[model samples]
Target: MPLNASLPRRDAPFKLGATALLLVDMQRIWLEPGLDPDHADWGPDHYFYRQTREVAIPNQQALLRAARASGVEVLHTIIQSLTEDGRDRSLDHKLTPIHIPPSLEAGLPPKRLAPVGDEILLPKTSSGVFNSTNLDYLLKNLSIEHLVVAGILTDQCVDMTVRDGADRGYLVTCVADACAAPTPERHSGALKAFGGYCWVAEAAEVVARFEALGRDAAA
Candidate 1:
């Protein structure tokens, strides 16, 4: 498909069992305030944190609730190194200096947004989960064909996941309000830049779709 081609929505009926809600990099390192005191500018007062705390987290919660109620599989990914010395990270991560020590609390998601029951939490050292993790195989095993993505850094991991997931033949939908970047410009720019790669919608719209799917299933 052309990069500028209009995105085509999946025509098949929405099936909860075949859809997964993937939360990307929603861990404490990004969500928690004051975790990076060294860079106080990037702390709670930053636009990223403000957006996350005021918008993304709440919207993601709604998405999570709807996904769970509709029986859509839920998965989360965090930027965590597999090795104690951080040697297992992808080359891109190493160069970008994005390393999260597994031993630290920063690797864990916030309590309210954390996975429950059998939901999967994948620790990845790369921005693209598909590039560093067995997520593709896992999704295949779960028979997932549609991926609903929400999480931090709209321009980075979330963007990469949408593009990669689309290229892998999965129908991907990005929850715009459930994602944030360092600035509003970057956040909106990413959506526009990758708009053709996947269906981009607000959390409320995605939740409504899930609810409608539930209603359809009941009928």
Candidate 2:
């Protein structure tokens, strides 16, 4: 069968990577609202990306707990303009104006350097992690195979990372309950679209897998 952008294989359970969690885009800016037609439902406090702030936040946190217990590396890829001139952001970000420059220009907001201590916060100008970042080198050095992805804007960042991971010879497991689009409909839609591309599992399932693995590893 031909590869469908909207379909993923339903046969195998995802093979875990070196056990790395590739978290994308949790900047205060991406969390902001826009009035663009594409973001008609987006507004400050409108709950457009509510699943992220509400559902995914807690779920991802629980996954993080499992990750730590399992000794999995956690990395964050946040989208931001590298320059005030906005040379990095695509026309989509530029036109959509999801965030004004300087705010997302890598200095201000909460996208500060790699979550302060152990977390590696990566800022990307593009959608895919391997597009220009050292993510490839980093993952390779760590011998990463399957990437457990969780983050905001499901159809965009989550989709891209899953696609790129598959292309780069890594298995991808996307925590569906721990993900969210700009809206609920799109969030669910992205899950359906990630069908053939990613092994979509609930956050609780991911945690359960890790816990079970931990017990097995100990035994």
Candidate 3:
């Protein structure tokens, strides 16, 4: 089957608040060949997965453009320990197994706390956003009420961020098309689980929403 053919297409118009599009852990290490999922002992069907080798990039690019045009805030989060000496990881970081393909121990470059200027990018050590990062403070200070999410590891970072955002009373939407993982099953499963805490929308739905908001603002 054509990889993305099974995905839903969305084109709805909705208003956007002072929303932020949070990009979670879409690092090169996660997408590039240097990080090999096959090494994880998964079968050929399970190895390297399809999302990175196929979909995701286009959806993310579209979301990025729409976010910039609509002037919605963009936030990024990455999982990286504080120091090479392991001081930043806390006991939790050390205790966590480093068997994952793109984990800190997998030689994935520790999240650099991207110097994004006005855009907020929080550095985290764990899967959950609020569990380790000051993202709560950043959101409250920005006075943001809505969150639009995109990034890699839909079953992990993206999933955790949306869950936390919703728990804290933010309007959370996950760009289902923009997130990547090793396989479609894992990606879809995460979307289903996070649906309780998020509105799982396609990239098109978010873009249309942003554009509609712009039109309403001008009208």
TM-score of each: 0.91, 0.77, 0.77
Clashing residue pairs found in predicted model 2 = 7-196, 8-195, 8-196, 8-197, 9-196, 17-146, 114-121
> lDDT tens string, model 1, 1-219?
898477546533457678899999998877777675445566558788889999999999998898888888999999999888899988887887777888988779999899999999999988899998999999999999989999978999999999999999998898899999888999999999988888888888889888887777677
lDDT, residue 62, candidate 3: 70
* Residue 158 of model 1, lDDT score: 96
Cα distance off (Å), candidate 3, residue 27: 0.8
Worst 10 residues of 2 by lDDT: 105-114
Q: Give the clash total for candidate 1.
A: 0
lDDT of 3 by residue, 94-190 (tens): 6863222233553332333232457765666788878888888887887777788887788887888888887897778888888877767888898
Model 1, residue 88: displacement in angstroms? 1.0
Superposition TM-score, candidate 2 onto the true structure:
0.77
Sorting all predicted structures by TM-score, with the top scorer first, yields 1, 3, 2
lDDT by residue (tens digit), candidate 2, 1-219: 656765535324433446678777766555546523445566666655565566877787788778767667788887666676786787777776543354544333343213435867676777777785888888889887767898877888788888888788777888888777766788888888876777888888888877765666667
Clashes of each: 0, 7, 0
Computed on alpha carbons, the lDDT of every model, listed in order, comes to: 0.87, 0.70, 0.69
lDDT of the structure predicted as candidate 2: 0.70
Superposition error at 206 for model 1 (Å): 0.5
